[model samples]
Target chain A: MSAKKTEYGEDQDLLMKKSDRRTFLKGCSVAAAAASAALTSGCIPSVAAENSEEMKLRWQEFFKKNYRLMTQEEKDATVARLERLAKLRDGLDVQMGSYPPLKGVLYGYGFNITRCEGFMECVAACVKENNLDRKTNTQYIRIFEMEPGKLDPGTGDGQYYHKVPVENKFYMGTQCFHCENAPCTKACPTKATWREPDGIVVVDYDWCIGCRYCQAACPYYGRRFNWGKPEIPRQEINLRQHYLGNRVRPKGKMEKCTFCIQRTRKGRLPACVEACPTGARVFGNLLDPDSEIRYVLKHKKVFRMKEELGTDPKFWYFID
Target chain B: MQLFLTGLILLVGITTLFWGRARASESSFLDEVKKSTARFDNRSVPLVKEVTEDTVLSHEKYQGGSFRVLARKKNIERYQCSNCHNDKPVTVNRGAELTHGDIVLNHGSAERGLVCIDCHSPEQRDYLEDKKGRKIDFDHSYDLCGQCHFRQKRDWIGGAHGKRVVNWAGDRVVYNCTTCHDPHSPRFEKRFPATYSVPLD
Candidate 1:
């Protein structure tokens, strides 16, 4: 992988590593010098001395290693720093943790089209759970009310439908499908987004360059790009977070649904699944034969959104 | 004062005796139901379809169909039917003067020509009755429901019909029929949904 040459006529991997190391060392030395100067100069405080914590946090944020490359200690330090920053900025005492996927468990979701009443309870729960930008009304889940007997989501109306569960209309929801052959991951210029071992497509928010390539590549309109800083009220912030899932994202980053990685990896159901009053959503391990998802796939008439595209979405829609 | 105290003690003793007896009978009945369900769950029926390698390669053992459904007796408004029908038996013909005016009876009553005795046991106001006249506890109302809606009952047992609550990993716990549907009027009412998401386009 390192031997490959690019248009620049240099080993891109080597060049990138060298530049990263140089910047990291430079930042460390500067922070050290500033700390010592602050300790020594008691009378005339430097600018770094006044906002040392903030400055250190910024430096650390800039120099933080990629989540996949971070050691255990580094991950812990990063989590602690993020928690502190959340507190400082929004007065939120957020708890962030990284949970690995369970062994022999591949998560899958089934949507019962016949049962969904277009309640949109899942949408509201998702917004609160994922800490989406309220000002822009950023949402990961969209419930599309389609004409009866039609399966095309493109023609469905997401906004105008009222008095839902109408006589002939059926509701279908869309989110990140976490496809096995995810095109969004391939479209990423920086390789910041990839499918996890448990088949959840996740994005490293820090590593995303905000190119919006993944957004264009996605056929289902799964990814959402932050146009501005997310407006999450301090009191409304969900403290429980995962590094790759619902952790508070910054401006100019890309994010999508991770099937509630923080909750699912910990053996709990996702907030959306629990919030659906109509029992339209079913989530479980595909590897478990007795799981409700597997049962639906076996017994019900099931179909994926875009089978011709061959994305191999883990999501399935079924009717009674 | 001495006579009053003696009478109070006697009354307490009698109440305790009756309570203990009732609890013992109820628990024994539940145990019997559990045993029967456990046995029934173990009997294997033919697979709905052949399990191919793609479906069952990494699949764990099939350990479903034995979950407890949520009980709705506690959530029912003015639950104790015996409070009103203690001394008198509830007759089916008490139409205009029916005490339960609030109940619309739009479920099977209007469509399938079902009366109160079709489900509720007249012999015991609190217990549900099957076609065979067996009394069913509120917790085991699925048995009563399954008698008529066989397909839905089959799906419910197979973990396809209702909602599973809490953890998705361990034993599946689901909500009962009454949890979502009112017994008198089983149809769900249409209403405005939750907050709308702004159009992304």
Candidate 2:
């Protein structure tokens, strides 16, 4: 063979180098061949439920079953049960985020219109964990699942989520839509409320200068500027914290979802993301072309909470 | 015999030339990708002397409005470690993972630096860039964070922590390090007191 042809032959041999290690880089031809063989031999994971009626019935029963309020013990048991369901659904194992010794911890709420049983453990979770001034312990996200039957209801037909867990309901959770162009960041006089590169909007307690620019700028009312140092017992203090994202946030500073940066920023997922059982919430980098969040936007017919206003939120919505 | 020896030396020299590129190809390939992404050949990842050199993350703690004190206290250019380690984990070669999640000392597991961006982002949690300045790249932390923690983001969904609705199924999608953690303080996870010792919680 000519010198160039010989080099090409060597390259082909290198490409064909196969020991048991081929699984790592099977290459397009090999992977396609394997896939084709598997499909021909009926080895592919099935797309349709083997028994659609059974699946539908089970789904119906799941919808009908009452997800009522639970005590600490009950919630713990419930968490275990949900963990089991998650493994069965996706074959992935996960543990939920828990609070300090108190039966309850950090307070925040979210409503999934499709899956929400509506007892609002989330609402209650926020109240107890956040020690919300009972009048306003309502800091968590609340999404109402709604439907317009008049439109085509398969997927892209819904406008907003309202009162989730209703039949044929899909839920959405929105909180502190921490925009890259956060109006809150703009309105801050003392430059207190600012966007973390990680994408969370935060308020520096000592540095805030108590300006409510963040609260006013937030359209979702997601930003909560602390009017006073929240009065919780020192004993109730959850001291394990990060400076900006966690720690006992002092009063007169604003606070919203840090995307659970204290936890989620770490390897762990956010409290609300972990708390969810139905597999609804999705988070990832907007910049990364291959990230899961990118894939969601790429494949699914997703809609930003508000597209016309031009806030360009990273948060998204869709129907299942 | 002399001619044979000369031939042998040429063969060995050529073999070693190819061998260096072969052995070092994976890292160089990743480095090439990183540079292409940033449109930068790195210039060089600077190394500064601060908390010894074993740890990869520089604890340039942010305060007030700017990275003034942090910049003044630490001589990053003098010891910019990234000069050598372009893309791979430092612990594997240059610096070690902060098994304790801390740069200087051991506090616990979750708090240490398992990844690079645990402490180096474009904008820090405090929203302050490095003292030298903030104009060098795409969200500083965004690119660096994912360079290490490829698995943690598999779970965050919506405004919550784990995926609930959007896209939690199909193939799992993990995002970058900055998507979650601040690089200044590399926390692996909340101190999973239960996972390790009994809970003080």
Candidate 3:
């Protein structure tokens, strides 16, 4: 290839190797300058505008898999695995990886599949919340089709709609329905994918060696394999970093739905739940009978995606 | 004006392709003037020449009957475009297989009129097997339909539409558009307001 004209300046090659550090500093400097400039002329990067640090961090970000599938000991081991990784990550904000241990956290989710429309808004939100790569986006929530009221479970295309609003055809989204007895963890040769406290399932992204066992063990087809390091623009990045979930995963991690643990465990709803326009997603403490999830369970005809396997999945679908 | 809609549809469709599964064929079954002027009779089909309120179009509309026509790719297969459409709505694909949309989704709205093609695209089809001996086409196929039924799309994206089954840890996942509707006709799986989850103010 011919020597390409460069937009990054003289040391472009040097800049490429240490993109994380240089990009972060550049972003911070840009924002700091922008804020100061804004104070004087109101012409800097506004709060609404993209954050350079966040944007720079976009390509480097990743999400861990279902943490809910892990047992206590393995979960702690997984936490340690993540901490070790934190020390080496490129754009580690506070401390690339080395930080605190997993604390007491809780997880839970509810869905009205009868109400699901299959837009993938939640996927986008998951990407943002977890700082996922723009390319792969890691999370594997595919919307499928089936006979309505028939409930054959994740059998349809999940993503193929031609003319659209395929009425009379059923729609169902498949994600890591965090199960009480997740089979993925059982099938793992290495204790990589595990369930976290608060019920969200997560993976030690660094520890995963790109094996497809967890994915195969997942009857729900909830797991994902990063075939390639995600390809994305640095400017389109998300940098509000988290240690466990989607704060920049690497090239070959096995990932799945975390119930937006980074958000939900902190009292916030997962991105998808909030993005649902139909309110088909009902999120709350499942243990709390008064919670909306409880109402859904009591009033709606709900069933797990797969009953024969008896994964004891936490995720359920309902029809009214 | 129609071109403006086409432009938007194109933009949305392209984005949708990457956002979704892969493809579905399309037909010129539903259109406003076509539906009003009318050619075919009853039984509701996608691309009949005539138009009516009770039925879109029937088998009498075309002879070849849902065959592939777009120069044919290697493994890609096209279905009868009019199998599910009719002139009462008149929607067709204009490229943007990315969205895979092809018709207008009323979502049980009284205001829903013709312009069905406004929401629907030509439907992208790719059955190509990948290096892993598995399919490598984009996922999220329903995104094509979500272009117009944006509210539904939003819900789907948020793990509301379709299945939205969540983790044992918690929260029902969101869905995509295809979970409920068929691109050819765009109807609900059950009754009116197929999506009762959305508020009706």
Candidate 4:
């Protein structure tokens, strides 16, 4: 009995040593993260920063699994970590949505060329809704004021600085078309971006290597890369975020429109569609036979941009 | 005119597609017209032969009918016009100051010479009147607008034109034509865009 007791005591001591080594390694990582953050941001209080929750979160975040491969628990953990990080870094209580795509729902958008009137309300709304980088004034949607008889957007002026619906000039708004046969997803070496079940093309910002290969492969100029860290004002940041949508992205990641997935997956219209005053923007389930998008597809003389490329873009343009 | 021609062609196509069903329901369609005419009290507006209000109004089994035309009655600034425009004349008459001084009637072209009384009911100030002397409720202003813009009305009903409020899925509630365009001044004026891109040059 005494020998057994002595053996148990020895096991306890060994366990103690192992735990001590783990604590030391953890402390070292936290210190390293805290130091790097302090050097980069230069705002964190040094003494408390080493032991801060933020440093531990940053260290954990670096080792997170790819979003698609993560199990439900892992996804939830990452979301919680992200929310905590948002609070710790920016004092934001952001609710990051992780809504799965609804069954039998494939979204399609219809743009009325006759009604757009070159009003950039959609662009303005998108920027606000998506929490686009205000410093760079990053805009996802662009309303091109096309010259009369020149329907080609390549020749149109996207930056018309005067009163819109300029007499004869028609307007065309363009964004990420969320093509059925997306070349961007094929071009992604890291498999960072891919089309969702409900037809939104999304990027796992954490998985992206910032190669910009997807951007190059895109024929519609859909993707935008972060050259510097996205600087969004705290007050201006949209509190309602999605894991793959409008969540605050880190530096050196690619982002484009996800048809406001944070809202759309919850049965809401895209921000740009809601903001269009002239009712030019039409969005609905392409699968629904009675949907406005389907009616437009059947009745209207609809055309898709870059159809020759076999992109099979879901977005359609129609004139009155 | 070109729009009308396109609409006519499309209408022909629609008529052809639904020809059998439409033919079988001809008697019921006539009965529906008679019913609506009786309900209106006074009906002189010529109903479009191709389309009818019954098809648009009824939540028919053929069409997935979970949609509503947005009600405009609640939002109107000055409702119950009969309260002020009662039979009694105002004792204090402020000369040259019309009751609705802000109103500038410019609906049709200047040559068309459309006055307030042309659309606004002289008999009942609250209700709008079509060319057929039919009184239309403020909530159903689309009925009044449809007298001239039938093609647009058809498109709106079939979900081709106009805005659907909020949701893209589930029940659709569409805005009235007057919600976007001022009935008095129907044309959208030229305005500066809300935002612009940074010059890429």
DockQ of each: 0.19, 0.02, 0.01, 0.25
Sort the predicted structures by TM-score, highest score first: 1, 4, 3, 2
Query: Given candidate 3, what's the lDDT at residue A320?
Result: 46
Stretches off by above 4 angstroms in model 3 are A1-106, A136-139, A161-163, B1-201
Give the better candidate number (1 or 2) by TM-score: 1
Candidate 4 chain A: worst-modelled 10 consecutive residues by lDDT: A1-10
Descending-DockQ candidate ranking: 4, 1, 2, 3
Error of 1 at B81 (Å): 2.5
Docking quality of model 1: it rates as: incorrect
lDDT of 4 by residue, B119-142 (tens): 889989999999999898877788
- The Cα error of candidate 4 at residue B139, in Å, is 0.8
Docking verdict class for candidate 2: incorrect
lDDT of 4 at A127: 92
Cα lDDT tens digits, model 1, A1-320, are 01111311332354467657867786886777667656646656675465667667766776776666666888889888888887776678888987666765668898999999898999899999998999999999999988987898889888854777887888999999998667898798877887776778999899899999999999999999998777888788888999998998989999999999888877677889989988889997776667777778789999999866767688999999
lDDT of 3 at B11: 96
Q: lDDT tens digits, residues B117-198, model 3?
A: 3332333223223223433222333333434466654333323334332321222222223323444445533322211121
* Cα TM-score per model: 0.80, 0.38, 0.45, 0.79
Among all windows of 10 consecutive residues in model 4 chain B, the one with the lowest summed lDDT is B39-48
Summarize candidate 4's per-residue lDDT along A1-320 as a digit string, tens digits: 23323543564465466556656776787678768766755665664555467767878887665676566888888999999998887778999967677765678899999878877999999999998888888888888888888867889998788987788788998899998768898798867787776778899999899999999999998788877667877788898999999988888899999999988877778999989999899997776667788778778989999877767688999976
Q: Which digits, one per residue and each the tens of the lDDT, describe model 3 over residues A222-282?
A: 7777777665565545544445666556777787777765555444557787665555676
Which candidate number has the best DockQ? 4
Q: What is each model's TM-score for chain A?
A: 0.88, 0.54, 0.66, 0.85
